[model samples]
Target: MTLFEQSGTWRPVDRAAQQVQTLSFEMPEGVTAFRVGLEFDRSGGGVLDLGCDGPHGWVGWSGGERSSVVISEEWSTPGYLPTAVSAAEWHVVVGLHEVPAAGVDYRVVVSRATAADVAAERRAQPAAPPVPERPPGRDLPAVDGMRWLAADFHAHTLHSDGALSIDELAALAVSRGLDVLAVTDHNTTSHHAHLAQVGERYGITLVPGQEVTTDRGHANAFGDIGFVDFRRPGRQWQRDVAERGGILSVNHPLGGDSCWRMELDQPTAVAEIWHSSWHALPVLRNWGGPLAWWLSWGKDTVPIGGSDFHREGSDALPGSPTTWVLCEGQDVLGGVAAGRTAVGVDPQGPVLLRVGDELMALGADGALLSTFEEGRRRIVGDRVVLPAAAGPWWLEDDHRCVLALCL
Candidate 1:
């Protein structure tokens, strides 16, 4: 017999990311078995998490790992701990991960059974590996009296969907000659807690980042500042991140299916037009749409690159086309936000930087420069007219291979 059957659509707002919405329902007397479930009806846009807390404390938190869950005295949802369903004001917690400007539409289903034993739900992901000691620092070149720090602004660990541990990722960064790394997990700031200790030991500026992820698009919030909810609108994020002394970037807008579809309400700080995609990125011309998108918002939105390092493979590893930030001290994010940056094809390859009125290609071994619009060819010099490099352009080798791109 049905004990509690209810459903409704929740239209979350800007502050919903840090909120815990609770729907209370009483457990009827003689309830032998209990079950709770949540479902979403949308094509693709944002992300919302699900969990429950009873009179005692947390009962289940499945996140986006599972759609619905069954909870009773015997078992519960995957990634959740089952407990006795006491008769009290039980609470259903909706963990808002992403809520679009149009809001989200959802439903909840809670019911009971006469007699049944719940099956063992899928277990939580293995506990994240213990943080390891910091590795020795690596060497990198200094440019224009300022350090050309090799950094990766987009990466992940087990705190999200990555396979490596925090320490493991750090070790790999060192191998890849990265001077700085940003741990941008899917949607949670839980990884930030371990950054200080681990980053100090690893000798790299481990900038705490959160990938404000949803089906419609994804972005990276860079800094060690406090958590920012992913459920708010994109405009809210740009404003909130800046107010908190952090920077924001639209990530991999040209990625298939995951390409950014969100409208730009404000002029953001950065754009990840060059990601680790073999078919699309700084090394390819498949970024016209996204480049035009950023260009439409004006030059305030600086173009940047990220390896999008999740795990080490041949597709792309950490710091493949390194982002060279010209900064004093350790102001990596500051350099990116200010557009004082350049991207190289590899860690030790040539880089294209805009110095004063000239677009300079340093250490390029005499590579050719060309515009994406095919307007002109700069086949003879390390410096091109600042006018020619205004829009989107690329540096290439003798074989016509794209080395680095700037938008």
Candidate 2:
């Protein structure tokens, strides 16, 4: 039964007045499930984000990736969480991401559903891909008991906007030779529940994460910490994530459109200085932008990398710029917290790592090891070791294309 329905035209003026608007409806008593559907004039070149909020607080958000979502006690859509139906006011939160000058008409419908309806509308889980044999582990030296783990700190799945399911994403990460893959869906933690089971099946660690998204910027909250509120200020996100025992990393600070433009009194401890967006242009064109941002951001900032992978042919594949963390076992977050990380062009590409007060450059013969404190030095051999100094070091080719980064 239809409980609430609304239709209106949203314009640029409305968006400027209020970025997010909510349509409220009282959930009927004894309802087994509920569904919210949003329809907007896509032809008008407008973008609308969809989400739900129960009386308790944030339920889920799919950004512009989904138009409709269903919730029940047993099952819910990928971007939403399943919870027991409650008799209270619920809200359909709409974000006017982009509104055309001419305005765009939109409609939102909220309906009650039965168990049978939810079962009929449930999406089937995708089959897991065959596990591929992993390549032999790298022999890079680490302190006494720690080992280097190849990780990709940013990637998405069907839980947000990516093309694959959690199972498929884990398999793909394993196949790409990643030891850890942080599943950071956009503004939601629905994917957190499935990480352990799927990671165990594919023999890789799937760290729970959420991409705290906003029009101003995007940040990644890493670990099993609950959802970080996207509507909050950027500084609040850093505080909340840290309070919840999770680490926040500013993502793709120089990413056009999605860059870090939000103001923060103090910089986040971690930042993704190397992103797959750099691949969209010529190698040498924007290589220095992220480096420049990092230098100005803070001296002790821990630099990381991510592919920001979504679907095939969209962004760089997982592990395209692998983040190697030196940690014990599967403690990828712990490694990140301690600032023990290095990034390479790919899992098997040239890398610069800090080892016991010395800098080791591997697979980087003929490349230049450049650091801010010390001047550039030509790496003559495949494996070269140099006296370590204060660093935000990188290995770049003759064309100045960055191949590896170490913090």
Candidate 3:
């Protein structure tokens, strides 16, 4: 009963660094145990620390047959863990106690395995390579009643999985003319250092974030920097995220053959409507699939899009659909929370959303359709046009609110 599913590399450091890096992600439910596999260039490597970060403090650590100082754990080339996780994001940290100065690169793999699967070496392989990155460009042209923009909530770099660095991603976002950008790595905030600096330097709002991981699935809880231990109970993780005022979102909702299910149904903050992984499927299957319809009409969740690029080696490209945020500024964090956003499918071109005193349409053909005005309603062709309500109004596409729209 693992809560989610995952398959991919988790290394987050370069080869030249003196210290090896540790990676963690939220754990899936019904994961009775776990396994570890390490590949190093040197034989006499330093000690690598492996364990889980509990809410109170350190709960589990490598020891005895379970503790090997070399490049891997001692339990089984791939360590075995028997723990029923709680309903929170748990932390899985891998520390290299004493790393050797190996000029060559190295990698350590950690994954969940059922007791039976371990007995049969039944571990799922990670997902395929990341798609191209989004090209950079400008603010969307402003319309009388609506404003159009582009955004990407999920992005990575050489610091994590993206092929580019923090500067490059920020530059690309700026060049692509996107208004919002969120950098989410596997399980670390290592990219924040450069991302923050470049974001401010380049006038791009880089959302400080981490891809809170689980053995079962992954969530992109955006906003400030917070921690969720993948090794602890799952409930605690969710509480911590909500308690801190962060918006929790389901990443790649239809991934891993639907192995990744939200721990809590009907998520509040974000549910990835457009992602690179979703591109492999057909277009109709992309949004019209049973799962898409379920997440859309059933939950009415906010739609977000991301490249999910690891930045391993190649360039970054927007795989398919893209998220368009109609934020106030280039501030990724501020605008995203404000709900000025929309998502458009690839080949469908761009979409413009407005929450103004009057409902006006500035079509690509330069034709204006005055559907409704302040405090008035009208019927235009095949559509029933309602005036902009005096109270709170929501632009369904970008997740933004106009004056009176209720949250």
Clash count of each predicted structure: 3, 0, 58
Which residue pairs show backbone clashes in model 1?
99-231, 134-201, 134-202
User: Which portions of model 2 miss their true places by more than 4 Å?
Assistant: 283-286
Ordering by lDDT:
2, 1, 3
Sorting all predicted structures by TM-score, with the top scorer first, yields: 2, 1, 3
Model 3 is weakest, by summed lDDT over 10 consecutive residues, at: 398-407
**Count of backbone collisions within predicted model 1:** 3
Q: Model 1, 1-407: lDDT tens per residue? A: 55555565556554354445777888877664576777776555757676667777656455655566666665554334456777787877776666666777777777774333363332443443343443343243455677667888788776565767777788777667788888987666657767778777767788889888765689898887655555567777777888899988888886777787887566566888667773334456333454466566665567777888767664578876678787888888877876777666667666776655566665565677766455435545443344443645667766666677664
- Give the per-residue lDDT of model 2 (tens digit) for 258-324: 8889988689989988888766678544368888898999867997888888998878999988999
Residue ranges of candidate 1 with Cα displaced over 4 Å: 1-145, 278-290, 372-393, 397-401
Each prediction's TM-score versus the true structure: 0.66, 0.97, 0.54
Off by over 4 Å in 3: 1-37, 40-149, 257-259, 281-287, 290-299, 312-320, 346-348, 352-407
Instruction: Report the C-alpha lDDT of model 3 over 1-407, residue by residue, as the tens digit.
Output: 33323333323243234232445556554544555444544355544444454333433434112332111121222122223444356554554444455433345454665555544442332222322344454334454444445667787654444556566667666655555578876555445555666776666567777676553567787766455554444455567777887776667665664335445633445567556654443443323342333345344455666777654334335423557665543544454566555554431333334444543222222222221133322223322233453322222221111111111
Say which candidate scores most in TM-score: 2
